[model samples]
Target chain A: MSTMAFLKRSPWILHYDASSCNGCDIEVLACLTPLYDVERFGIINTGNPKHADILMITGGINELNRAVVRNLYEQMPEPKVVVAIGICAATGGIFRECYNIAGGVDKIIPVDVYVPGCAARPEMIIDGVVTALSILEEKRAKMTGAAQIKDDARQAAGETT
Target chain B: MTVNEEQTTIGVALEDLTREVKALQTDGYRLVQIGCTDTGGAYEVNYSFDRGYQYRNLRLTVGPETEVPSISDIYWGAFVYENEMHDLFGIPVNGINIDFKGTFIKTAEKYPFSVTRRGGDQCRNA
Candidate 1:
């Protein structure tokens, strides 16, 4: 089913905190505040992974949470976008030196948008969400186009036979 | 919230950890946190117990094959820190109340902070 129209109006996000300090987490919350009000962009933050079109992850990947991150990413349906918010999620930041740190979110999963900051600013996070929405749209378009091409090829083969 | 206060330190062997921790518990001190610092051949594991403003730090210098007994029996909260020691330093901190085992860290390198890491490895022996 083409849920592209539904996804366009409401691209819900699942926020996952891997191993970051509260700095990046607080910034994410800031986006929900009246001042930032990210809902204007047709965005909503949801806890459930199944409901999320975008995955907003903050914090560096560690060994234990690597599987957790992967599971959440896999649970989200296709045409999903991953937004790695903060320096930690983008590159592991200072935590990279720590023995337990695996690295950035990209190390475990594909990331479409990266919002860089020690603790990413709310504005940057909003921008990242917008960017992710665009990427999600692009992916949906590509997916539908590929399906159309496949259907056309099957039809032509049946006609020839 | 920074304060300058005198902190007491007591050196205890790994075997004596459980007994000493029990004694501190008897004195009405709360188990704060256990810290493990890598010291090449050995690990200096510090257990910080507090009663009000005063702090008493119990330090244990343990090496490979030395199993630091978990004092989780005395302080139920000791498991978290002990599990950390188990995951990183490979100290084999046994009898943990909430055993995470090696599940504490999600890193590429196993026992990355452990002194048991092979000699002359790029990061180790540096």
Candidate 2:
């Protein structure tokens, strides 16, 4: 029995489009359709960052939205995994030639999983989320250990003060 | 007889664009979109507007050094277009109601749509 075994069972997701063309976005939505129903794995598409266990980003980060991406990432508590959902998110797709297009989601934030494709298929998106779940569980284990160490140090400091 | 839905293009001098846009605004026309194209060190600016059903365009050629007057006075909504023109095309614009200060189409690089390419001299923001 793992310390945070329940945490790995139901990991919520927060979907964001850095600045994509909506192609990958539709595919991500398709994963929620009856055909895919990623929810069977307990992956919930959430709108709130507080409830998000996985941050799924689907576009190249522009300078304007760079701050916005950082803000959402910072809001999500520790032990979270970030999944770059498509080619643009993994590496700014067609817009890479354009003057303003930045490189990838990892250029702005840390990415645990990278799904490759112009518009990644629904199955691949579901697969990426499944991979993200494992990463989230790993991070959660590390985070719990770090929190306990910090609490012990703080308690020691309190005894002296 | 019904009027064709085709858009008509009008070429005007940079000096006369303000006057033409003002007249069109007074005549109940709306400023649609402004498209800027860079060709051989010159900016080919196309200003589109629609009155009721028909759409008209005003075309003008200007150098990158010249500052174009903001059409937001005529149509407040034009501020967005004018701001985009300034941000992308590096077209100097004055007096916008709500200026994004060249943040409209936020790109990785600055003045991305400008005629001044990577080798040439960079613009003010660069």
Candidate 3:
């Protein structure tokens, strides 16, 4: 089996509440409960950025948390996915015009999926995670394909020598 | 025992602020909060205190440039509100126990709540 198979089997998620009113954060938590049971897919909720495969951000980017969001995004490994879990993370929602809000999660980091809701429902969050898994696999495939091209170039150079 | 009480607000002169806050402290009142409102370029600062479920407020209207003395010496935790007031309204607060120097709220625009809100982008290291 390829590494992509393992990637699909287990995907670690990191949830960050950039500037949410706790409405989206609560829904994100609801996804973890037995009623939703996202863990059934072998998706684990992680706190450390380095261990996260999907960044599930729940709020808009604010001046105070912009640096924090950037730091967390940078710390995550390559070929990772980001899911904007609410309208706030999608376009800063109602706070887009606020003085402090910089904008959505995409303003600070690349977002692979956007789940739209004032407070995203747990079902929607699960659906977003499922969507993020596909994006993560695509990114992983692209990375491996590039490596294969590099290896072939090296082999061709060896044959010429 | 009855716990009914009415909220009382008394206007105070800016210079008499420290003296008035000290009196409240002596009377065994705990500082509830310090809130500032921008009232047409000037500032209305309200000092809220509570003693036995009774809410009392001291209101001070000061010019935009007036320096407000910090009541942190009396309440100790008043520095939080003082710093917030200064950061949001560009109000000058003197002698805070711990001053963040306009870094209290980490807003994108400095004094964003001020009538004349001015300043460049601000970002603190995470």
Give each prediction's DockQ, rounded to 2 decimals.
Answer: 0.50, 0.60, 0.86
The predicted structure with the larger lDDT, 1 or 2, is: 1
Output the better candidate (1/3) by lDDT: 3
Write one digit per residue (lDDT tens) for candidate 3, span A6-25: 66857998999999989999
* Candidate scoring better on TM-score of 1 and 3: 3
DockQ of 3: 0.86
Candidate 2 i-RMS (Å)? 1.8
As a TM-score, model 3 comes out at 0.93
Fnat of model 1, as a fraction: 0.75
| Worst window of 10 by summed lDDT in candidate 1 chain A | A1-10
**lDDT of all the models against the reference?**
0.84, 0.83, 0.87
Candidate 1 overall lDDT versus native: 0.84
Q: What is candidate 1's CA lDDT for residue B96?
A: 77
Native RMSD of candidate 1 (Å): 4.6
Ten-residue region with minimum lDDT total, candidate 2 chain B:
B117-126
Better of 1 and 2 by DockQ: 2
**Candidate 3 lDDT score at position B60:** 98
Clashes of each: 5, 0, 0
Candidate 2 CA-lDDT value = 0.83
Taking the tens digit of each residue's C-alpha lDDT, what string does model 2 give over A95-131? 8766667779999789999998888999898888888
lDDT of 1 by residue, B8-52 (tens): 999997677788889989999998899889887888999999987
